[model samples]
Target: MSQRDLAKHLGVSLGGVNYCVKALIDIGWIKAGNFARNEDKRVYAYLLTPKGIAEKAALTARFLRRKMDEYDALKAEIEQLQAELAADGR
Candidate 1:
């Protein structure tokens, strides 16, 4: 998608999208190439590099682990609250 489209879909400013794209490109994580959409139009296509793929996988794993920890903590807290209520004959 064009940068304008990306910005619209992400609900962010065009400049923010532009800056992020430039940063990714600089990091060698994503590459940008131009393609012809029509006789008079050119559009850029961004593709993730292998490094980017690995980075995404690592991030996903970390996110999942954090969420699981949060869930476990909440479950323990709820159980403790229930036990307290039982002790009080509620």
Candidate 2:
């Protein structure tokens, strides 16, 4: 998708997408190339680089681990609370 499409899909403003994409481009996470030309020659397409793929993989793992930790903590707390309530006969 183009940056416009990405912004709309992400429910953010175009400027937000531009800022984020620019940062990623600077870090070598994304590449912008000219795919086809219209009446103008300023259009370009963006794709993820190998570095970006690696970053995505690492981010996914980190996110999953954090989510699992949160889920486990919440679940254990709920169980403890249930047991306490049962013991109190309420």
Which candidate wins on TM-score?
Answer: 1
Clashing pairs in 2: none
Runs in model 1 with CA error above 4 Å?
36-41
Give candidate 2's TM-score: 0.76
lDDT (Cα) of model 2: 0.91
For residues 1-90, write the lDDT of model 1, one tens digit per residue: 678998999999999999999999999889988766655455677999999898989999999999999999999999999999999999
Per-candidate clashes, comma-separated: 0, 0
Give per-residue lDDT, candidate 1, residue 11: 100
Model 2 / residue 71 / CA error / Å = 0.5
lDDT of each: 0.91, 0.91
Q: List where candidate 2 sits over 4 angstroms from the true fold.
A: 8-13, 37-43
lDDT of 2 by residue, 1-90 (tens): 777889999999999999998999999999987857575566787888999999999999999999999999999999999999999998
TM per prediction? 0.85, 0.76
